[model samples]
Every structure is written in structure tokens, then in C-alpha cells.
Target: MKKRIYKDIKIRKLFKRYEIRRRLLLGLINDLSIPLEKRMEFVSQLNRLPRNASKVRTLNRCVLTGRSKSVYRFCKVSRLALRDLGSQGLIPGLSKKSW
Candidate 1:
């Protein structure tokens, strides 16, 4: 019997892009102190970037939010925004101490 190998190639690709965008947006939010509600708009702009952009190697949006903006504008996870996110759980794992 041959061993079977299962790999979700599509998911892997999507996740890779998601992670990149997530990190980039997080950094921008932290530095700019942008609100969560407005972050989506910024992310949407980035999602439209040309495919050649190295930061977003792939084109994929956050599944939870279902917004292409997730590809660019990430909710601020800094201590300042943590209090709000904590109460609302708007962005997961975004804690005051994470920064």
C-alpha cells in the first residue's frame, strides 16, 4: 500500500498572502493609530495593488471579515486599541501587551 499525502495547496497559498497582509496592516495601524472600522477601507485600497508587489505575493482576503480591505488595513493591536478590541473582540489576539 502506498502512503497517501494530502496537502491543501490553495489554502497554503491563501494563508501565506493573508499572513503578509495581516502583518503589514498591523504595523501600519500601530504606527498610524487608525481605528478598526476605518482599517477596512485602507486594506481595500491595498488589496487592489498590482500583483508585482512583494508584500502581498498573493491576492487573498480575510475569511472572517469577508472584506478585501483585510488585505491591507489591519485593526490596530497596540495597547491603545487593545482596550476596544478586548471588549468587542473585533480583532483576535490583538492584546495591549502584544506590542
Candidate 2:
């Protein structure tokens, strides 16, 4: 059925998005030097049940820099930026909630 096929496609996309988020969040937490437990908590809070394109773009901007040529480029930028922020202790805590 066409509807079943569409549903399957949607589910696959959702799984892929979750995989991306997991990878990105793990990288972020590692760069920030947060404990694994805390990282998991942050990821749980940040994860969206349904991905939104606008939200993803906004998060990408926050985590990365440089012109968006491709996903690999973005990943590089994000890793570098995260290291810089970590070294500077710029990563915020709960009290500074408004980012």
C-alpha cells in the first residue's frame, strides 16, 4: 500500500535523524568535558520526538561555523568550535539557562 510505504519511509527518516543527533550530542558532551551521565541527561532533554528543519538549522549554527558546503564541513566546524568553547569554559550551566 502507498500509505504503508510512506509510513515506512517516515520511520526510516526519523531513525536516521536520531542517529545524527546521538552522534552530534556525544561529540558535544565530549568536547565540553561533561560526565557521561550528565551528557545523557542533556541529550534526553534536547532530543525532539519529531525533528524540525528550522530547529536543526539553528542548532547547527550554534554548534558550528564557516559556510555550509556540506555535512562533513559542518562537522569539522562544530568539532573545532566545541573545543574552543570547552577550553574557554564557555559552556553554560543550569543557572544560565537562556541561550
Candidate 3:
């Protein structure tokens, strides 16, 4: 688990460092006003960036237990923790529904 967290942190740091440049390159690549040659250059630069810098490489982890599976994006918590909190009425506007 710690190894997973460390890997995620490393990826996140790389992503942060390259995020602005990546966005700029992507924008340049997609801009129709730019010359095709310039756009191709930008595409090559983007491709040269480390693959771990991509957002797709980041994994969501639970806030409470650091579990990677069944995470709730809105709350940043694992499903198990969310369910427990909901059952305890600790989270407002969230409740367990009964059929």
C-alpha cells in the first residue's frame, strides 16, 4: 500500500511539473490557426514528455484509509467508509436508501 502511495505521489509530482506545458502543447496542436509544421512540432514535444506525466496515470486513493479501490470521487473517501459514515448520519445529504 505504501508503495502504491509512493508511486502515485511520484506520478502526481511529475504531472504537476509538466501540466502547464502539456496543456500548452495540446492547445497548440489543436489550434487550426497554427501552421501545420508548428503543430507537428508541438505534437512531437508533447510526445517527448514522460508518460507518467499524463493524468491517466494517476490513481485515486481513499482519504481515510488510503485504499485505492472503490473510491468515491466526490467525497474522496472509500465506499466502505462512505457507507459507514452514511449509516451513522455523519455525512449530510447522504443516506442509505431502502427498497
Compare the candidates by TM-score and give the number of the best one.
3
Clashing pairs in 2: none
TM-score of each: 0.26, 0.31, 0.80
Model 3 stretches with alpha carbons more than 4 Å out: 85-99
lDDT, residue 19, candidate 1: 65
After TM-score superposition, the amount by which residue 28's alpha carbon in candidate 1 deviates from its true location, in angstroms, is 1.1
Q: Residue-wise lDDT of candidate 1 within 1-95, one digit each (tens)?
A: 01111122344555565667766765765665777767777677667654344443433443333333333335423344445557676767745
- TM-score for candidate 1, residues paired by index: 0.26
Tell me the TM-score of model 3.
0.80
Model 3 agreement with the true structure over 1-99: per-residue lDDT tens digits: 777888888999999999999999998899999999989999999999999999999999987778999998999999889988899999999967971
lDDT of 2 at 95: 33
Best by lDDT: 3
Tens digits of per-residue lDDT for model 2, 12-98: 566566766666765776666777788777677556445532234232222244323332343444555655665666756413223
Better of 1 and 3 by TM-score: 3
In candidate 1, position 57 carries an lDDT of 42
Show model 1 residue runs off by greater than 4 Å: 1-7, 32-40, 43-99
lDDT winner between 1 and 2, please give it.
2
